[model samples]
Target: MKQKIAVLGPGSWGTALAQVLAENGHTVKLWGHNPAQIDEINTYHTNRHYLPNIKIPTSIKGIKELKEAVIDVDAILFVVPTKAIREVAKEVAISVNTKPYIIHASKGLEQGTHKRISEILSEEIPESKRQEIIVLSGPSHAEEVAVHDITTITAASEKLEAANYVQDLFMNDYFRIYTNTDVIGVETGAALKNIIAIGAGAIAGLGFGDNAKAAIMTRGLAEISRLGVAMGADPLTFIGLSGVGDLIVTGTSVHSRNWRAGNLLGKGKKLDEVLENMGMIVEGVATTKAAMELATSLNVDMPITKTIYNVLYEGKDIHQAAKEIMLRDGKVENEFS
Candidate 1:
C-alpha cells in the first residue's frame, strides 16, 4: 500500500532516500532546514549543493516546515545528523497526529549519555505516538544508492514485524533490505564503523599500502565486535552487513565523509579545518568521543578506537598514532586478540 512518508533532512542521504520513496509510489515530503535548498528541490528538481548533477524526482515534495512535513504522515524517516536527531524528533513529537512508524538511518551514540538513536527517540516520543523504532543500516553509501547501484542493507528492530515493515518499505532490485532483530548490534556496528573508517582513511592519506588498510579494517572489526558484545549485542551481528559490511564500504570509499575527514587529517589538516572544508558532518569525529566513553565505561578494550580517538581528540600526531598501533604488545589475531 502507498504511504505518506516524511523524510527529515535534505542532505545527500536523505535526498537519496526521499527519491527512493517517491519512485516507489509513496508520497514523500522531504523536510529541510535550508530554505534555498528546499526551493531548489521544489523548483528545479535538483539539490545541487548536496547531490550534484543528480535530478530528484519531481513527485517528492520539498517541505521547509517540519510540522507540515510530518503531520499526518504514515512514517517518519529520520536521516538527520546524530546530534540533530533529538531536535528534529522533538519537533515531530509535537506536530504528528498519528502513531507513525519511526525509522532512523542516522548512526552514532549521544556524546555524553551514550544513548543509541532508538533510545533517544524512545525518550523523546511517547510510546502512544509511535510504533517500534527501526534502524536501517549497512554498508550502502548514499552516493551509490543515489545512482541506483546494487546495494544491500539491514533493517533492525526489537520486534520482527517492525523490521519486516521497514524492509518492505526500502526493498527493491537495486536496493535490497535484510531484516534483523539485533538492533543493538546493528546500531552499534553502524556507529563504531565510522571511527574505524577514519583510521583507514588516515592510513590511505599517509600513503599506506592495501596491506595496511587491510590490517586496520580487520583489527577495527575486532574492536567493534568487542565493544558491541560488551553492550549486550549479538556477537554474530558484527560479522553481518551492519558490522563488517559497513566497515568495508565506509573505510574504503572516497564518498565517505568520515574517511574523507580522516584523509584530510592524515594530510595535516586540523579537525576544525577539515570539518569546515568537507561541508558535511563527519560522524566518526563525534562518535569517536562517544564510543570511547562508552567503551571505557563498559571496560571494553578497543585499541583501534583508542588510537583513532587520540589522534582525533588528543591532537596526537597521525604518524605517531600509526606507530602506536604497530608497536603495541604482540597478540593473537582472534576475536579477543
Candidate 2:
C-alpha cells in the first residue's frame, strides 16, 4: 500500500530518504526552509546544496511551507538536524490536526535541555495530537544510502506495532530495518556515537594509524554504553545497530561530520576553524556539550566525552587531553560489573 510521506527537511539525509520512499512508490513531499533548495529539487530533481551528486525522483515534490508538506500525509519523517527538531515540531503542531505517526531520523540530543528528539516531539506536539513516535537510526551514512548501498538500521518505538510498521515502510533489498523497543538506548546510542566519532577523527587527524583509531573506537563504545546504561537503557541495546553498529561506521567513515570535526581538531585546528571548514552540521560538537552535561548530572563516568567537551569548549589542548585520558585511573574491562 502506498502512503503519503512528509519529509520535513531537504538536506542530504532528507533527500535520500525521500528518494527511497519515492522509489518505493510512495507520494513524498519534501519540506525545505530555503526556497532556492526547493526550486532546485522541484525543477532539477536534485538538491544541489546538501546532495549535489544524487538525482532526486520526479515523484518527490518539494514544498516551502510546512503545512503544505503535511497536508494529508499519512506519516511524517522528521529528517531535520537535531538542533531544528523542536522548532519544526512546534510549527508542525499548529498545522497538523490529525495525529500522525512520527518517524525521527535526526540523531542528536538537544543541547542544554538534554532531551532526545522524541522527547522534544512529545513536548511540542500535544499528547492528543501525537501518534506513536518512532526512531530510525544506524550506521547508515546519507552519502552511501543515497547511492543505494546495502544499509541496515533499527526502527524503534515503545509500541511494537509502530516499530514494525516503520520497518515495513523503509525495508528493502538494499535498505534493511530491524524493529526494537529500546527507544532510549537507540536514541542514546545514536547521539553518543557522534561524540566518539569525533574522538576517532581526532586520532586520524593527529596522524595516528589504524591501531590508535581502533583503540579509540573501542573505548568510545565503552563510554557510550556506560552512559546509556546509567540512564536506564538496556545494556544489550548498546551492542546492536544503534549502539556499536553506529559507532563503528560513524567513527571510521570520512562522511561523518563529527569525525571530520574531530579530525580537524586533532590536526591542531580550533573548534571555530573546524566548524567553518566543514560547512555542514557537526552534530558531535553540540552533542558533546549535551553529553557532558548529561553525564555529569547522571554521575556517569564518561572520560572520553568529557575530554572531547573540554577540548571543544574550554580550549583545552588536544595532546594534553589525550595525555590526561591516558593518565586516568585504570579499572577492569567491564565497568558495569
Candidate 3:
C-alpha cells in the first residue's frame, strides 16, 4: 500500500531516503530550512550540493513549511541531524492531528542529555498523535544508497509489528531492511560507531596503513559493545549490521563526515577548522563527549573512546593520545561487553 511520508531534512541522507520512498511509489514531501535546497529539489529534482550525482524523483515534493509537509502524512521520517530531532518533533506535535508513524533515521545521542533520537521524539511528540517511534539505521552511505547500490539496514522498535511495518515500507531489490526488537542495541551501535569512524579516519590521516584501521575497528567494536551492553542492550546486537557492519562502512568510507573530520583532526587541523571544512555534521565530535559521560555513569570502560574524547575536548596531542592508548594494560578480550 502507498503512503504519504514526510521526510524532515534535505541533506544527503534525508534526500536519499526520500528518493527510496518515492521509488517505492509513496508520496514524499521533503522538508528543509534552506530555500535554495528546497527549490532545487522541487524545480530541478536535484540536490546537487548534498547529493551531487543523483536526481531526486519528481514525485518527491520539496516543502519549506514543516506543518505543510507533515500534516496528514501517514509517516514522518526524520533524517535530520541528532541535534535537530527535538526541534523538528516539537513542530510535528502541533502540526499533525492524526496518528502517523514517528520514525527516525538520525543516529546520535543528544550531546548533553545522552538521549537517543527516539527518546527525543517521544519527549516532544505525544503518543496520541503517532503510531509508534521506530529507528532506521545501519551502514548506509547516502552517496551509495542514492545510486541504488546494494545496502542493508535495520529497523528497530520495541514492538515487533512496528518493526515489521517499517521493514516492509523500505525493502526492495537493492535496499533491504531487517527488523529487530532490540532498539537500544541498534541505536547505540549506530551512534557509537561514528566515534570509531573518527578514530579510523584519524589513523589514516596520520599516515597509518590498513593495519591501523583494522586494529581500531576491531578494538573499537569491543569498546562499543562494552558500552552497549552496559547500557542494557543485548550484546549480540553489536555483532550485527547496526554494530560491526556500520563500523566497517562509516569508519572506512570517505563519505562519512565523522571520518572526514577525524582525518583532518589527525592531519593537525583544529576541531573548529575541521568542522568548517567538512560543511556537514561530524557527529563524533559531540558524540565523543556524551559517550564518555555515559560510560562514566555506567562504569563502562571505553579506552579508545576516552582517548578520542581527550584529543577532541582537551586538545591533547593525537600522537600522545595514541601512545597512551597503546601503553594501557592488555585485557582478556572475551570477558567484557
Candidate 3 lDDT (Cα, 0 to 1): 0.91
Clashing pairs in 1: none
lDDT of 2 by residue, 1-337 (tens): 8888899988888888888888888899999889988998899998776776788799999999999998787889999989899999999989986778899999999988999999999899887776899999998888888999999999999999999988888888899999999999999999999999999999898898998888888888889888888888899998999999999999988888888888888999988877887868888889999999998898888888898889988989999998888898877888463
Better of 1 and 2 by lDDT: 1
lDDT by residue (1-337, candidate 3, tens digit) is 9899999999999999999998999999999999988988889999998998787899999999999999889999999899888888898999996799988999899988999888899999988989989999999999999999999999999998999888988988999999999999999999999999999999998899998899899999999998898888999998899999999999998999999888988899999888887888888888999999999999988999999999999989998888889899877777274
lDDT of 1 by residue, 117-225 (tens): 9999999999999988999999988878889999999999999999998888878879899999999999999999999999999998998989999999998999999
Identify the superior model by TM-score, candidate 1 or candidate 2: 1
Per-residue error (Å), model 1, residue 119: 0.4
Off by over 4 Å in 2: none
